[model samples]
Target: MSKEYLDGIIRRSLEIRNKYHELERLHHGSEWTVEEDALAYLTDAGLVGRNIMSQQQRWPKAGSQTELEHKLGENIWWLIVLAKRSGIDIKDAVNNFLTETEAILK
Candidate 1:
């Protein structure tokens, strides 16, 4: 995707996250901690593994394609959100990783 499209996605994700934080503050008297966000991201990451197992026919219960797709998107969203919260630029981090890995392989 173009950087503009990716940035738009990130912007929208942050907006939604902020809205949720507002609801959380209203109900709980505070927003979620970064640790809590990490926990949530880990939970969804586990779901991604479970979905993969189901797809491989190793899981007892079949995973819905819709659920898997949603989880995948959520995982990426969580990563982007987490990076922003940690004061890291997600785009730059990704680019650096790619460049380094490519160089290593060469």
Candidate 2:
């Protein structure tokens, strides 16, 4: 992706993180650390996995694909937030990983 696209993602992710923090402060009287946020999103990703399996089996309680998509987006947002908090440039990190993987494959 272009740098513009990555920057937009980072901007939107930070907006989402701020909004969530505000809501969390109102509901729980505190915001969680980046580590906690990451863990929570990871747990949500697991739920998405369960939903996928249930849908595959045609189970009654299975969540819709839209729900899974939303959860996946949330997971990405959480990752961006964590990276920001940890002083890492998410775009650079992703690019480095892709480059390393491609070199390994070659």
Candidate 3:
């Protein structure tokens, strides 16, 4: 992806994270720790996986496709959130991963 696209994603993720933190503060009175955020990311990922499985099996309920798409977006948002919380630049990490994997394949 282009730098602009990646930067846009990062900027949007920060906005979402701020909004989510505010919501959490209203309900829970505090921001979550890095570990808690990581757990939330994993939970969302698992829900996405389950939804994918349901779709593949043709056993999806009403609006399952929409729910799947929503969850996929949530999963990506949480990934960026977790990366930020852990002080990692997700774009750089992804680029490094691609480079390493390509080198291994070569």
RMSD, each candidate, Å?
0.9, 2.0, 1.4
Against the true structure, candidate 3 reaches a TM-score of: 0.90
* Candidate 2 C-alpha lDDT tens digits along 20-60: 89999999999988778878978988977876776677555
Model 3's C-alpha root-mean-square deviation from the true structure amounts to 1.4
Question: Which regions in candidate 3 have their CA more than 4 angstroms from the true location?
Answer: 58-60
What's the TM-score of each model vs. the native?
A: 0.95, 0.83, 0.90
Model 2 alpha-carbon drift over 4 Å, by segment:
58-60
- Candidates' C-alpha lDDT: 0.92, 0.84, 0.87
- By lDDT rank, best first, the candidates go 1, 3, 2
- 2-99: candidate 3 lDDT, tens digit per residue: 89998999999899899988998999999888888888888988888888888887565666678899999898888888888888998888889999
Best by TM-score: 1
Which 10 consecutive positions of candidate 3 have the poorest summed lDDT? 57-66
